[model samples]
Structure formats: structure tokens, C-alpha cells
Target: MNALGALAAFAAASSLFCGATAARHSYAEGDKVKLWANVVGPFSNPSVTYQYYERLPFCQPLDGLVHKPATLGELVDGNRLVLTPYDIAFQQNRERVTLCSKALTRREVQQFQAAIRDDFYFQMVLDDSLPMWGFVGKLEKVAPATPAEKETHRISLFTHMHFDIAYNLDRVIEVNVSTDSSRTVDISEDVTPNTEDGTIRAEFTYSVVWSPTDIPYAQRMEKYRRVQFLPQHLEIHWFSIINSCVTVLLLTGFLATILLRVLRNDFLRFSRDEDAMEDAEESGWKYCHGDVFRFPPNHNLFCALIGTGTQLFFLGIFIFLLSCVGAFAPYSRGSMYTALIVLYALTAGIAGYTAGSYYRQMGGTAWVRNTLLTCVVFCGPFFIAFCINNTIAIAYGSTAAFPFGTICIIAVIWALVTLPLTILGCIIGKNTRTDFKAPCRTTKYPREVPDLPWYRSALPQMLGAGFLPFSAIYIELYYIFASVWGHKIYTIYPILFIVFIILLIVTAFICVAMTYFQLAAEDHRWWWRSFFCGGSTGLFVYAYSIYFYFQRSDMSGLMQSCFFFGYVACVCLGFFIMLGTVGWRASLLFVRHIYKAIKCE
Candidate 1:
């Protein structure tokens, strides 16, 4: 009861937080407009971000410092907003107004040069509602005058910014930033050692232009969706989805043929072959009926894995459905992540029930321990990786590091809400569970399994079983990776949902066929083997991530690499568990159905 109350409170709080965005305001003429600086990072690596003024020598606002409070999701997404010192009146044009004058030290000059060379971009908000982006500076290469001379480069920082604010009646609809190349100051020439007092002085200036537009404020975000290479991206996405659908059809047909023709013959022969069974002439899967339903080893861990997988399976479905329906706005900061965290908390009971019921069915005696294990099965490793990444982020002074308060809140939620509901579920599952009833009884003495060919072995079968499923989603993986590690916005949730279904169907069909072949080879250890066969797709995904990091992406530096691989490893781990459980459950049903059809003396 206490847990239920806590969960309700948390849900309400999360709902309010997620609903809170930049407040839209109706501005009158000559009203003071507020501007905010959000974050700055190298354009090449989107995940590596820092506070806007963290490494820059920018002037702070004089009339007391003010910061916009960030929500849980915003903090997690590495957004920190601080009011800038710029003064602008709504719908009032100003030209050549000096925003700040800063005396740059040698270090500050070097920082600006590095920012330009790395193509750093900064994000700012206008009227606390619209986001605008601009590059910090520019780097241009200079051709050598003589053929024997080496080429050099020049770095110039954008000193003047021109803001174009579009208005619709009393509301601001769009904000754009443009800079003139002629207004930039050459850092190399202005910051030479011959400068007086070894200090270079620079002034940042800006101009504002107000224009009226008929476009509605609601549709203002449409322009940001028009990304570069959009047509090519859509083409590849459609091709991949279509390719996956065809693969799923072929696999479904193949599995259907095997189930109808091959399984029918096996069932017919096994049901009418009493003489052959007595004479020890029976061969293949039917001969291993007695051992097929025998309990798998390490039943506790297996049950926990299955339960966690089931939880992830449902989580995936809900998230995709919500995204397809536009419940999570792609342009809204941290909306998707906030939804994920809240939903995962709410689904704790599902994991508990699944692990508990499956454990009870497997004749497990320690129900409490099983429930606890189920809770930690996925979160434990993820937490460890998160800690390591957070520590590294802190060391590098990146905004990606989670604040101490955020960590405490997460811990409290897990302990107070998620833990209690899971306990309740475990209690219910344990009390209401039924025994596992097998069609064929196991013999007192175990049967000796015959040797099989290399291709029929566990390792080989896992490799073969995982390849097709990986192929089904490998292309989609590229887009997902690009969205996460690059600057692309992924809004095609409907296609993602379709591809997700295709991947699952392909995984289930492939696992079922593999289990059938393993049983035909008289290997009754299909329990763990089935799980691994399905989970092996994650291995392929991680391998592809390695290739992408080196060959396909522009990501560099140690901090970025650690962040990429560490989080990707955790994702792959979850993927492995989820698909593994799917395969294991499908094989279990297939085995039971086949065994139930055969006659045993």
C-alpha cells in the first residue's frame, strides 16, 4: 500500500515535469526579451556537450545571475540554461550594439582557436521558447603562394551576431542566427605576442531584426526537421524496412513448411511405431521425449533472465506505440528519456511476476532470492556502467555527468516504489503458481546422447541462428546509431515499430527451427542453447558498433569513445536477454506440443 502511494506520487510529479517546457509568452512592443545560453559542443560528436560558457571567456550578466531550472529529463539530457547578458527589446531593431568587451588571455585565445578548428556550435533560446544554433567561429585553409611552401590555415572568431526573430501576432514563431564573414576578427593577427601587455582585447557585437510571419507557432519546429541528406536517409530507411519484411516472409514460409510436413511425418511415425521402439530402432527427436522436458540447469538464473526479458519486451512495445502516436515530441528535450524512466519504474511488477511464476513452475524453493535476482538482473550491470561513465564525464568536466541529487532521486524511486511492487508481485506469483507438467515422464537412468556434426553443435547453431535476425535489423541499426551519436533527429517511429515486429518474428522463427534441428540430433539441452541462439544477435550488433565507431563515424577522443562503447555494451546486454527469452519461450512451446503428440509406453 505504501509502495502504491509512492508510485502514484512519483507518476504525478513526472507528469508535471514532462509537461513543463519553455513557457510561451505574449510580448508587447518594447517589452524586454530574455535570451538564454544552453550548451556548446563539437559538432562532430553530439554526445559530448558542456555548459555554454564552461570553456569560453564570455561576459556574464551584470544584474545578478539567473538560471532556468532544469527538469529531471533536461538534466539527464545534459542541458543547462543560463541567462545571457544580451539586451534586446521585442520587435525593436538595433544595429551594431556592443554586447560585451573581454580582454582575452593567451589561454582564452587558444581556446577560441581550438573551438573554431573543431567546429564547435552553441545553442541559445529566444523568448525562452525557441532554440537557435550557431557556430562559435570558422577555420579557413590558405593555399600556399609558392609550390614549395607548405599550406597554412587561418582561424577567425565570429564577433558579430545578427538575430532574425519572426513573430505571429503577439507570439514569436521562429528565431534564426546569421553572421557576416566580414565582421569576424582574425585571432592569429589580433592575438600575436607583440600585443601590448600580452593581452588581446575583443568586442562581441550583435544586431536584431524583427519580421512578421503568418505561420503558426505550433508548426515552427518544422524547419529543423529539414535536415541535410534527408532524401537519402529516407531512401535507405525504406529499403531496409522492405528488405526486412521480405526476409520475415521467407522465414515464416520456411518455418511453416517444416512444421506442417516434417513435423507431421515425425508425429505419425512416432505414434505408430511400438515395435520399432521396443527393438531400439527409434531415432531422432522422438527418442529423446523423456529428457526433453527435464528441468534446465541453474533454473533460478534462467527464470530471472526470462522475467527481465519479458519486462523489456513489453517496455519496447509501449515505448514504440507511444512514440508512433506522438506522445513523445521528438523536438522536446528529454521527453523520450523521461518517458522511458517513468515507464520502467511502473513495469517493475511485471518483471517480478514473470520471474517468480517461472521460478515457482521450475520448482524453485527460494522465491525471495529469485525475486531479488530478477530486479538486479538488468539494472545491476547497467548501474555499474553508468557509474563508470559518469565518473569519466566528471573527470573530463562534461555536462553528461549526472548530478548527485539526480542519483539520489533515482535510488529512492527504485528502493521505495519499484522494489515494493516487485515484492508484492513475487508474493502473488509464488502463492498462485502451478507445477510444470510434462507429457512424457523422465527415466530413472539418463540416456547417452550420440555425437553430432560440427554444424549441429551449440556454438555453430548459435552463430547460424543469430545471423538472420541480425540481418533483419542491421540497416535500421545504422539509423538508430546515427541518431544517438550524430546530429540527426529520428522521427520515423512507425517504420521503427514495423521493423521491430519483423525482427521479433524472424528471431522466433529462426530459434524454433534451430531447436527442432537440435532435438533431431538428439541434443535435449535446448534450454540454454535456445536462449543463447536468440541472444547471439546482440553480439553481432556490438560487433557492428565497433565497425561504425571506426569506419563510419567522425567520433574521436578518449572520453567520446568510452562513452560510446560503455553505453552500447549495456544496450547490447539488454538486447541479448530480451531476444534470448523470446527464443527460449517459443522453443519451450514447440517442444511441448511435439512431445504431447507422440505416444510413449
Candidate 2:
């Protein structure tokens, strides 16, 4: 043949040969050992939930948080995490994709190890080549409900995912709640491997491990009660806090009337009877008609803080309500947190405006403090938490999909939308202050500033009042904290409401008591005092977290460190918010009381 013709024929033949050859795979049987893994949740989702996670980038981060659990079909499926599956081991890479795999080798070992290390805190539980064998699994659960929803007050759940391998995952897995499954696991899943590392894709039967407890709702709640706080109870606290503030306000108003009218008429009134002053004996000074309830600190500043806190209270309520309504369902991904962040920003706007306006009216020289503190209260701690978590994710090779760009967007949202709204409110308040004048008068000289009475005189009492509400909700707070940090699966939104109730009660009562005590002691720096009394609860909650941390031996040092900062962030935030609330109420009360004292004299 001619040279060119020979070359062309050879090329064509080689092309045909290459096309006919079987694709190369490093995980072929007998080639190497296999790598083992399980799904990340306590219980596996339906095929659909699997599909959902497989599709979302944001949710991909969550997979590393949970572990595979069993189903109720154990009687039928036997002891297997992966049942009735084809190629269960899935691989995703930058190149060649295999839609199936039933066996394992050195290549799978390397790949599985990489993925597990990236997502899990624990080392691989098992690493061995498939013995060309298979297993089955079962699971069951009942959804929570009231009598009207379920006669037995139980939600039944059943699930199973099993796998075996001749060439890939294969087995029969079924989960059912009706079966006698006192021991049932709640979490597990299977991943699609990216073995080729070349944009290939695959998914197999999923597996999960759990504590395997299936019980009635009451029983579950009993367990939860041991760990969770009811948010409604928190609401009771909220109301109590509110009522306490109101009671103080009423006292101030009543005293303002008596001092301004009766006491002033007897002494300082422009048209007063001189004889009335001589006759006005201290014994005749009625608590209701005389300005006896006098001593309020920073009346203007306190009112401003309270108004902002009120706005935050409602904002938090709305956010929690949304969370309870399924805004943040596991299947729904991070929607709940996203919603929560936005709501927090919204609340910040109201708080800022209220505080700024009130501070402005109180002749505050520190405008920057007003805005900066407000901003920090709303954003700083969360930022610190995010930074710490992000640092860990960097080391682990996992990243939040939203990234810094998303964070910038959130900042812009707060700065542009919330900030402007706040500034506008401040302007409005400044303009309208004359219409509703505050009663706290600026004395020529600041009233006799005393030595720091924080320790010697009444620090213990102040601390106790601040933490009273926190004590009421510690149970629920524990569960909520676990849900967020322990990687434990639970519904804490309801308990959050209970916390709100309790906070209201505690805040109000504590504020009332603290105000009374401070007044009785003649400590009128009411602004900071109110904050000191109310914000102390957050500190108490933090103390409990410290206790929990010192006691928990299961957490790794890394987890412990991360959790410490995370919890402290939450505590600091709660502390400031409570402070703002207490300060506001105290300011309002003090002002009213001053008017009564002046009138009564």
C-alpha cells in the first residue's frame, strides 16, 4: 500500500479498536480494597428527599451533619442499612462518570476516604472490600400530634434502604413503624460517588444508624421535656416582663400626678396656700397622693431602650413562628435560617430607630454609641460565629455555598434598607418629641454620683433578678442548643415559643423588682441599671452552656472550641437585648416618677 493510505487505514483501525474496548475502572473486583460509608442523618429520607439533596448545592453541606439510621421494616428487611439497591456506591468527579458500582477496590478506598474525611468528624467506621455480599434494614417513626390529629397521639413512620454487590449495591431494605421495633434507628443515606473526578455521577442504596427508639408522642415529649423548653412558657415570661415594666410605668405615672398636683400645690405651686405647707405633715403624705415613689434613673434613656426591645420582641416572635410553621424543615434546606437572618435585620432597624430617637431626645452626646451598639447587638456575635465555623470548613474542605458574596449582600440589605428606616425613625422621633415631652428634667448638675454600688450594696440581688427568667427556660434552651450544635435531630421551634413566654414574664418581673430596689437604694442611674438587671439572664444561660461543655466528654477538642465561641456569641447577644429592654422600661418609669415628685413637693 502507499504510505499515506497505509497510515489512514491504521488510524481508522486503531480508532475502531479503542471504541470497542471496555472502559477502565480502578474499583473493579479483586483490583483493590473497598471504602465504607453511611448517610449523614439519623434517618434516611424517602427517595425524593435523596433526590432533593442530590440536586441542591447549599444542602450538600448539611449531609455531613447526620448519620444513617434504621427503619421499622427490620422484621422484613433484616439487619441492613442498604436494601434493594443497584450500584449503591456513587462517585462525583471532574471527569468520567460511572452510573453504577457494586464492588470495591483500592481506588474506591482512596475516594471514599477523601469524601468521609471531608464531611465527617469521626474516622471511617469500616474499610474493607465487599465480600460480594448484601444486607437488609428496617425503620419506623410516628409524627407528633395532638388527640384531634391522631387518636393515639403518635405519628407512624416506616423506611428501609439496603444494598448488596455482585458488581454494585444490591439488597432488599424496608422500614415500618407498625412492626415490633422498639429499637429503631432514625438516620442514614447513600451517596453518588465521583470516582472518576472528571464530572461523572452516580448514587446507590443509602444507609443510616440511629438510637432505635420508637415510642408514643407523650413518651417522646417526656424525653424532650427533659431537654426542651416550651416557648409558650417563654411567652409567659415575656408577658411577665412586660407586665413588670407596665406596673413600674403605672407607679411612675401615679406618682407623677400626685407630686405635680398635690405636693407642688402644698409647697412650690405658683398659687399655693402658705398655711398648707405647714399643715402637710409627713404622716399625712399618702403613698397615692404624695410623690413618695421618686427615684428613677435615666428616664429618657431607659424609655428609649425599652421601645427598641419591644420592637425586637415582636420581631423574634414572628421569626420563631415562621420557623415552627416549617420554614426551616430539613427537607427545605437552610430556608429557615435565611428567613431568620432577614428577620433579624428587620428587627434591628426598628431597634435602631427607636433607640436613636430616644437617645437623641435624652440629649445623648454619644450618637455613635447608639448606632454602633445597636449594630453590634444585631450582627457582631453572629459574624464571629460565622468566621469561626468558616475557618473550620476551610480546613475540612467544605464551604457554605453562599460564601462571602452572599454575606456582603446581607450586609447591604441591613445597611440600605434597615439603616435608612432607622435613621428615618430617629428623625421622626426627634421632630415629634415636643408633642409628647419626656418628664425627666436635666438637672444643672448630674445627681450625686455614688461609688460603684455593683458589689458592696446590691450586686447579688441585681444578678439574681437578671437571671430569674433564664432559669425558667433552661430546659427548653438545652434542647434548642443541642438541636443547633449537638447534631441531634429535634423540633425546637415550639420550645422556642415557650422560651419567649418565660422571658416576657421574667423580664417584666425582674425589671420591676430591680427598679424598686435601685430606687429604694437611691441609685438613679436607671439606664444602665435596668440593662444590668435584664441582660443578666443571657449571662446565666451562657453559664449553663459552660456547665454542659465541661461535662460533655464525647465532643472532640475541635468541636468543643468551636462550640464555646458559638455559645458565647449567642449569650452575649441575649445579654445585650435584655439590657436594652430593661433600660428602656426603667427610663420611662423614672421620668414619670420625677414628675410626681416635683408636683407633690
Candidate 3:
């Protein structure tokens, strides 16, 4: 036989031998171990809820288990629940525990350990017919590891569990682990254990340790009532809320004063007295009544902003409603971002329709260009920001980056679904017979805007108008940043929705006041100022984002910073669009009403 044939035969034999060894390494058998149950937490002064572990695989069940729930009297001695500090072992109220499986192989135990360690948490779910595993927590590890062990590979959780919070022991359902001694455990397809030394034996044991605290139920439950269960500073949040309320109150007071006093007097004098009306028009905004509603420069962009803002407004509303109803509770992994993408895609029509209608009202001849720009204006910036962030994530090899296929899928959704719907909406809006009625006729010449003090200039008014709305939402913004960067859960959707509504109301009121002041100062170039007034809130939000990144969060690395800032920019841009639209609408209404009230003829 040739040497080549012999070498090929040898190689084939080696492959078979390796494959057989792997097949053997896949499954192993071991002795029976008990799964114990315990109540172990309420670890801090303000903590009330105790963690219930259904199965602690390491310790013998007879060591620390309680067969029955402790009575309220047993729980507290004088002012505190009978404490069990971690420094001392729990010795009382112990019982043996039954297992879901009477015994598991050494390999099976290792696989479960690997799953818990990698996933950061695990749970055991009870079923009458067949029991299963359930929820998990992402918390710091409690054990020490060898120097060679990587942080991610360390087994942090050993049969940790989740169960319903029950007042009585009987109300908590328990399931016995299956006592099948002959059961074999196969190495999971996903989890690969390091057992090269042939020492992959069932040697590790688990225990249930309780550390009790004296915190009452009311105080503990109050913490959970907030949107964030864990925050950097809860007291700071309270202060922020108070500050926001004060700002809102101040703005509301000023607006009320204007509406009740200044505007009222202007209306009365103009309506009842002809001489005062004629004199008022000589120098102030009354002179520009004929041109108040004239289509501003860059009408296309204005229309697009309005359209995109309309879409985002409703999209946010839908998200809040769905989240409040608990739609994202069961499967929250990546759900919020998924919902945002899908909802925004579906709401494309609103953007197109609004922009098209506004453009048409402005007597724009380039309908196609206007409609296309409406779609591109906001989305273009968002897509660019997304790409930059994703690229940074990919360079860092972070799992947070969207895969190429997911990116392609998102693109397809935008192109195939969103684009067509937007175009259809634009067509419908353009064809619709909506009125672009101006109370007064426009003159060939534009009104001369009077010189004003620095405080009354557009920039100052914009800043002031923006600051009040920002103050209204700066508290909620912290929670949102925590949720995004700190991996904290933001479950209080109802409160978030309320805050959103308040922000809108504040923006509108401030914009109206700013617009009224600008007009009263005899400045007819209020169109852009009105839009910019509320949109400037985004600048404040962006500034807060920077502060949050540096002060509140511990996140480091350039990629992380880039990703954070990129997304924040997009968020701020969206805010700018939404608040700007509110300002524009408010100013529009105010201008119309004031001009129409005066005798134009």
C-alpha cells in the first residue's frame, strides 16, 4: 500500500477515536443529592421582602430549612425580626428537602452550575405535571475564585430560586424534585465545562444562608413603588422632583398672569375701543397682522419637523400604554428597543401625512421633494447615529451591537414598509382639501422687527422657554438614563406617561408666553423663535446626558462613551422635534386668535 493511503487510514481512525471520546464525555451518572428550601434575605435596614430559595443544592436540607412559615411573633422580637447575621450559621427551624430529580449525574450538576454562573441567576418553577426552572437576577457574586478563573466563568449562583411573595407558608406552593436514581445528565449543548484533568466529579455543595433585617414592610414596599428599584441617590431624585414642580409652578404663574391680565386687557381695549386698536397697530405686533401667517423660509424643513414630531408623539403614547399594561414584563430582553423600532416604522404614515399637509398649506409646489425630505430629515440623522454606535460596539466586540442580519432586517422594514406607507400618506394629505386660512391678508413687504433688549431677544426667550420644560422632566430623565446604562428596570410606565403630558403642557404654555412677548415687542420674526423655544429643551437634556455619563454612571471605555453619546444625541434630537412642534402649534394658535380679534378691515 502507498504511504498516502496509510496516512489517510490513520487520520480516519484518529477522527473516530476523538468522536467516541466526546460521546462518552457528554453523559455521566452520580449519586442522589437533596434540593433544600429556605428564606434567606431581607438583608438591609430598609429591606422587607425576604428571598425564598426553593432549592439549595449544596447544604444538607436538615441544616437550615424551615418546614413551616415563621409566625409574626416568631419573626419579630420587640422591634426587629429575629436576625440571622451572615457571620453566624443558621441552626434553628431546619428540615430535609425533596428533589425534583431524586439524583442527577455529575455532568448534569455541572451543567446546571454553569448555566447559573453564566446567566447570573436562575429559578425553579412548579408544575403539577412537570416542574421547571424560571426567573433570574443579575447581582454581584458571593464567592471567591482561583486566580486563574475569569470573572465571567465563576459560578456565582448555586441553585438560587424565585417564588411568589406569600404571607403564609401554605400559600407558597412547593414541588418535590424527582427522585430518579438512574437518571443521567448530558452536557448541555450551550454550556461547555472545563474538565480536562478527569476531575469533573460532583464535589461542590450548596447552602441556604439567611441575613435578616429590621426594615418594615411599608418602607421597603415604598422603594419598590418607584420606577427604579436601585438608584444612585434616591434623595436627589426627591429634590429633583421638587425642583421640577417649583419650576412648573413658576411658569404656570407667569402664564396665568399673562392670560388673566395682559392678554385680557389687550382683548378688551382692542374690541371695545377703536382708537386704542388703531394706536396699538402703529408700532407693535398689531401692525404685522396681515403677515403673521405668511409661510416662513425653509417651509419644507418646518413641515418635516412637524410631521416627524407628530409621529414621535403618538409613538411615545403607544409605548407607554403597552408598557403600563405589562406587555413587556414576561419578555423584557431587548423588548423596549424592539418596540421602539417597530412602532416608529408603523407610524411613518403620520409623519408623511402631516408634513405633506403642512407643505401644501404653505403653497409648496415641490410636493415630492417636500414629502421625501420629511422622511429623510429626522430618520437620516438617526440612522447615521445608529451606524456610528453600532460600529463602535462591533469594534469593541460587544454583544450589544446589532448583527448584520438584524441591521438588514431593520433596513428592510424601513425601506419596504415605512417608506411606502409614508408616500401613500403624503399623497392623501396633499389631495385633502384642508384650509390654510389666514385671518388677515399678507402684504408684499415683510414687517419690520423692532430692536429689543438682550433678555427679550430670540436666544434668551428660547433658553427661558426651554428651561421650564426641561425642569419639568429632569427627574424622569435620571431614571431613564439609569435604565439604559445601569441595567435597572423602569417599570413605572404610568408615572412616566404623566410626566410626559406635563412636559408637553409646560412646553406649550411657555412657548405661548414667549411668542406673546416677542409679538408684543413688535417682532414679527417669531416663526423660527417659536419652534426653537421649546426645542432648546433638547440642549438641556443633552447637557444632562453628559453630566450623567460622567457623574452617575461608572461606565468607561471610548466605545461605551461613543455608544452612549450617539444614542443620547438621537434622543435629544427627537425631543427637540417634539417640543418644537408643541411650541409652533401654540404660537400658531395664539397668533391666529390675536390677529383675528383685532379689526383687520
The lDDT leader among the candidates is 1
Candidate 2 similarity to native, TM-score: 0.54
Query: In model 2, which range of ten residues has the least summed lDDT?
Result: 41-50
Model 1 TM-score on a 0 to 1 scale: 0.94
lDDT-wise, the better of 2 and 3 is: 3
Residue-wise C-alpha lDDT for candidate 2, range 388-447, written one tens digit per residue: 765664453332222454557777977886666666665565555543353443443444
Report the Cα lDDT for residue 52, model 2. Answer: 18
Instruction: List RMSD in Å for every model shown.
Output: 3.1, 19.3, 17.5
Off by over 4 Å in 2: 1-311, 323-331, 365-373, 400-402, 435-442, 449-459, 489-495, 590-600
- Report the CA-based lDDT of candidate 3 relative to the real structure: 0.60
Per-residue lDDT tens digits for candidate 3, residues 70-112, read 2221122101112111111122211222223224345545544
Question: Which scores greater on TM-score, model 2 or model 3?
Answer: 3
Worst 10 residues of 3 by lDDT: 20-29
Give TM-scores for every candidate, taking all chains together and pairing residue i with residue i.
Answer: 0.94, 0.54, 0.65
TM-score preference between candidates 1 and 3, better one: 1
